[model samples]
Target: MSLLKKYCLLGAALWIACAAPAFSEYTALSTLLAETASKLEWNPLLESGVLVKDTTQVVFTVNVPWVIVNGSRRINVDAVRRQHGALVFPESTAKEIRAVLEQTDIPPKVFRVAAIVIDPGHGGKDSGASYVHTINGKSIRVSEKDIVLNLAKKLHVTLKARYPDKVILLTRENDTYIALEDRPYIANTIPVKPDDAIVYISLHANASMSSAAKGFEVWYLTPNYRRDLVTTASVGKEYSEIVTIMNDMKEEEFTRESVLLAGEIASQLESAIGAVTENRKIKEGEWLVVRKAKMPAVLVEVGFVSNLEEATRLMDDAYLQKIEKAIYNGVSHFIEQFEQSKGFTE
Candidate 1:
């Protein structure tokens, strides 16, 4: 054999051997399992030792001290050594690591939400509901439109104070009526690039004829209803495919995170107001407000204005201030929770 030919054949064999192991290694790992692996250019700090996989859990050692698994269809990583066998990741460390990985263009193992839209339901001629009261011996009427506007303003201020650069928008800042459909339309119209993370929150006060229902309640759109309605409504229409595409996009954007966010907000609200109000629990509702929103959307019924006692409280300036504080605290708590879980900051 000639010298050049032999060298060429040897080089080809080496390439094949190297390629074979790369392919084999990934093949042995399930796609779902492999997804748990960090896409960040594997750093020495993150990959100094071998990752040992066992039947129930996976472990890493030395510089590669993080453990990861696909839990509940999401990638969960923990630093087993630092926690002294605990499962939680500290917020500061996680945020730093995530920022580093993100800068390097690594697809995040979990998604984090940043921007939010707040909608205060009802306004203008809508009047919503009216309640009369005698204040200092003069009759006064409290309108739902005004109450919600004030609440939305308070929420926007609180969110911006915490998030700063995070975009917080309101559907209506004044008593002017904004159509039900236009609320979600504003969310959909936001010029968000594919890489941006945003969510929507619509605030409303619930009313009941019994005047007995009162408390804080949070809501995420009912998925089954939104999907079915969009699908059915689009059938035989020119934009059927468009509707399918949009529905699919919305599902991808919202579904999982929306539920988590709703729960977090509800929990915080309950904590904030527990001393003074009833706990109405978190729930899912199929209202048009939630259903049509393009992002992970939730509608919060802060309390029922129907209950005479609650109505009186709602009309009180001091009570409204308390409600504002509670709602703001809930939203802030939710944002912090989301950032921590997804390992993001700001």
Candidate 2:
């Protein structure tokens, strides 16, 4: 018999033997497990009190609230435990599981993705922020523009290799200047099918005078763009007004989805660069690429080049590979979650 069926039978027998109040309806975590997981096993001796297999197996250990989801450690509000010969946890735990199920659930409809746009910030004459380090009596200069361009190229290559069928475009393929307003315009010009999805990622490296400021972060457009922005166009009055109205609507329309994607990327960044620093954060910011792009867009500060230690690490080829992989994983995760949430079957 299935776990849920057995539990129902047991509950019926117990109801006949004792007062109904003895058993609370809310404690049916096993029913939730049976409904959600393709397979579940309860073994007290096992390190995790309960084992669930959902595409991949995840273990929830007793007393330890964290659960391993597809090899990533995610915080769970409550720990898994065995009670009265049954695997159980707090009601909040069930709610958490429900949330995960909702995120991963397959949707009835799918939005076809047309293209993925990659923007590397500050190119050509704009060398962007730089940090100088002396090594063996030789001066080494690390420029944010160069590092971001390199990283964007690596990401482009990786994304192309992984999603061969998808259209992936880079704003500037080399060290050439592309106006901030024009970057998103390039993506906007791409022809796509109706309701097709598009994603924009702006690659950047932050700098600070404090030198102590270092860590990865992601930024999405906030909802209140019109109130926060100041119009600066004087010559192209008509064009400026049209752009402003479009940007304002885009920001308000995609805030929730952009924040969701940002959260996923930020969460994975913490795992990828945890050794470097655990101070990763996500915030709302207005940047041309993020604000002007009429799609789910985000700006990622891979690392701070201003900090001496981070500059050295960011300059490393192998570390750059890790950052690229982290970004790929985060983006892939968001795509999957978004597809499932939207009920996209394709």
TM-score of each: 0.62, 0.61
Tell me model 2's lDDT, rounded to 2 decimals. 0.68
User: lDDT by residue for model 1 over 179-288, one digit each (tens)?
Assistant: 99998888877776443567788877777777677888888876555454245353334333234433443464366667867887787777766677787777877889
In candidate 2 the C-alpha lDDT for residue 85 amounts to 43
Q: Report the backbone clash tally of model 2.
A: 5
**Which consecutive 10 residues in model 2 have the weakest lDDT in total?**
234-243
Q: Please provide, for model 2 over 102-179, each residue's C-alpha lDDT reduced to its tens digit, 9 standing for 90 to 100.
A: 465533334556688999999998878887986546689999889999999999999999889789999999999888
The backbone clash count of each candidate, in order, is: 0, 5
Considering only N, C-alpha and C atoms within 3 Å, which residue pairs clash in candidate 1?
none
Q: Which stretches of candidate 2 lie over 4 Å from their true place?
A: 1-109, 226-253, 343-346
